[model samples]
Target: MIHSVANTDWQLASTAPLLRRGLCSLAQPLVSQTQRASRFVFAEPTIQLIVSGQLDLSTVHHHITMPASDALLFIQPHTCADIGNFRSIFLSISHSVVETLPRGFANTQTTQSISKSDSPFSTLALDADLSSALQYVISAIEDSQMSEARLRLRLQDLLMALAEKGNTFHNGNPETTTAKLRAMISEEPSKHWTAQSAGKALAMSPATLRRRLAEENTRFEHLLVDIRMHHAMMLFQTTNWHLSRIAEACGYRSTVRFNERFQERFGAVV
Candidate 1:
């Protein structure tokens, strides 16, 4: 079941299998006017169903709008902003889901047939079939008695419907160490993460971690800051917490330093 918070915090119920794998449900009753705009970075392919209000997301060269009841597919991660008031369900499809598809379903031929635009985002029209399928998946997630095996079947059905509607989550790119670090750090940004500590957690030596991250063209320090900044951005969007509290939650003892880092990452004052 979805729990509504009084202070506008997006409290997630992690009882569902998908919740453990990145599926997020949010229902914000009141979003402060000052909090309407903030930067966002989607680390995985996500499909957002706007339950109420509207959302406007813009990149450097593109701007798209989604009104209530519309669905949006973020095919890849990019810098963007949120506008308008909205309660939405954001589902980040994990890589493993693609492997569960029918053997030939996620292949190159399937992706090639979906669409021509290789754009990073697309708006999906919720036709009768797709809408019904989405509802099924949502209901299954909300049902506390839902079995993991049954829920997986429901999710697979929903994905199949999405594919028929020209939105497929066939990601071929291998998950990099950079992505792994971001996911790990994002879970607990307030932790005093050092290269040595992170390396130990990741089953590698500090030198090995440095070498892997260097190969990915990123450093451990950079990943930590990026995760912290992104975590702060999400808090700004989903909660009514004061800036000082948000800063402290993101691992900064000093609000001024957190503000500076947020500005540097998003190129905007939050």
Candidate 2:
């Protein structure tokens, strides 16, 4: 079954108070074989520390695999799927906090270069020192006596460690043509997107775009439909919009068609 972040059922812990204060919280969701592939969208910058197992996070423009000794910081409004059975800790930082961070905090030299594109996600290896510090933070989260102020201090320390390491923010290389195309379609799911229009936007010929996507085991139409369906599910859960409005926003002129597709994807009605 496909699970989205909007579905609160997947959340195993409660962090409402921490989230309301614009502070970070820790989540340890149990990932089983039955629900191995789960989707999530981070509205703010998030730092994920893998405590055990392997986790694969894939976005429209990037694919990141975090083993037991890796961590990541994601700073965009990108939708990703969490593939694999892994118990992990997530530290979600508010956008305001990220914006106020110093320029060098991201450790740019180790980051993968994406020409003319700005993506805020980076991968880093978990060295011994960093791992110890992360362990402390995790412990603090479980401590009943750990006040909000104290927790914030620990978070600051973690951030400092990430910045000082210098190699934790590396992205590796520019996004592939297929990844860029996927991102474009996801960003504007409401638009009447076609391979030709996407090609124009990416400054590539339609044939070239199609070929690149084929190499990635995906097609332009498939990507468009997937993006639209995902958006529709999000809206259905988060908003009280009518079915017709949802269908229109998903680039469908007919609500009937939208409902049919939605049922096909989720085995339910809107």
Candidate 3:
């Protein structure tokens, strides 16, 4: 089953079933929006299917692109990428999914194959087995009657198939407090977030939270605005909501203020 995003309903197509080992979502940019130098933190391994558009990404060491129908794989966790893209299908591999692989599942030669790559991510065409596996996952998503156990099995099959091609996701490093903060706020950007409130949510004192964020060279206020601005971009690209409504949804009551922040963050206007 594929999640659908339309121009006007405002659902934003965020309800793709997040299975234990995997999750799938469609990225259809209804508007012609191109973001520049946007930082993306990947908590887990992710693969993108360039269904009908291209994607350009820059990391610390590499810059790569995938044309239409090309597939890109990111095996490293706690990594970041700056992307420029439009239409694509993204599937994420859970850390535990790779951690649970049977012993001897990945041989030395196959492991070297990934290590030989200069970049954490690789680009390739979809093989027959992988294509079939993706289709099975989609079918399972559409079938609401599909059992959770069955879906997990299907996801395992898909990942195993990828492993056979020498592309395997590994367990990610522990997430930093900054990363954790971003994830928490992204879940509901419209919420009224303050240092004290966010600190409570993360089980830290407000002062401790501020200290941790400063150690990471960031501030609590910065992360909140960053998360909200990114959410605004998603809504702008995926939905047909007006600026005022989008601003409200992102915890802003004044459209002018929201526009000012967005312009400062992305250097663009909606």
**Candidate number achieving the greatest lDDT relative to the actual structure:** 3
Candidate order, TM-score descending? 3, 1, 2
Question: Listing every candidate in turn, what is its Cα RMSD in Å to the true structure after a full C-alpha superposition?
Answer: 5.1, 11.1, 5.1
Candidate 3's residue-wise lDDT over 1-270, tens digit each? 343322122122343223332333333443355555466655567776665556777787888876665354544765677777655565655555556667777787887777675666876557666767876865775566878678767777887778787777654635678877876776678899999999999999999999999999999988899889867766776567889999998999999999999998877876
Q: By lDDT, rank the candidates, best first.
A: 3, 1, 2
Better of 2 and 3 by TM-score: 3
C-alpha local distance difference test of each model:
0.65, 0.59, 0.68
Q: Could you tell me every candidate's TM-score relative to the true structure?
A: 0.75, 0.47, 0.76
TM-score of 2: 0.47
Question: Backbone collision count in every prediction?
Answer: 0, 5, 2
Estimate, for each residue in 119-205, the C-alpha lDDT of model 1 and write its tens digit. 667777766686667667666776668776777777788778877666776453366778777767866788889999999988999
Instruction: Give the range of the ten consecutive residues with the poorest summed lDDT in model 1.
Output: 2-11
Q: Please provide, for model 2 over 1-270, each residue's C-alpha lDDT reduced to its tens digit, 9 standing for 90 to 100.
A: 112222122232332112224445455534433333345545344676555567777766677766755445444444355445665556655433434445655545443332234554667666667766666666666665778777666766776787676523232223677557645565567898888999999998899989998887989887777678866765654345689988998899999989997777655676
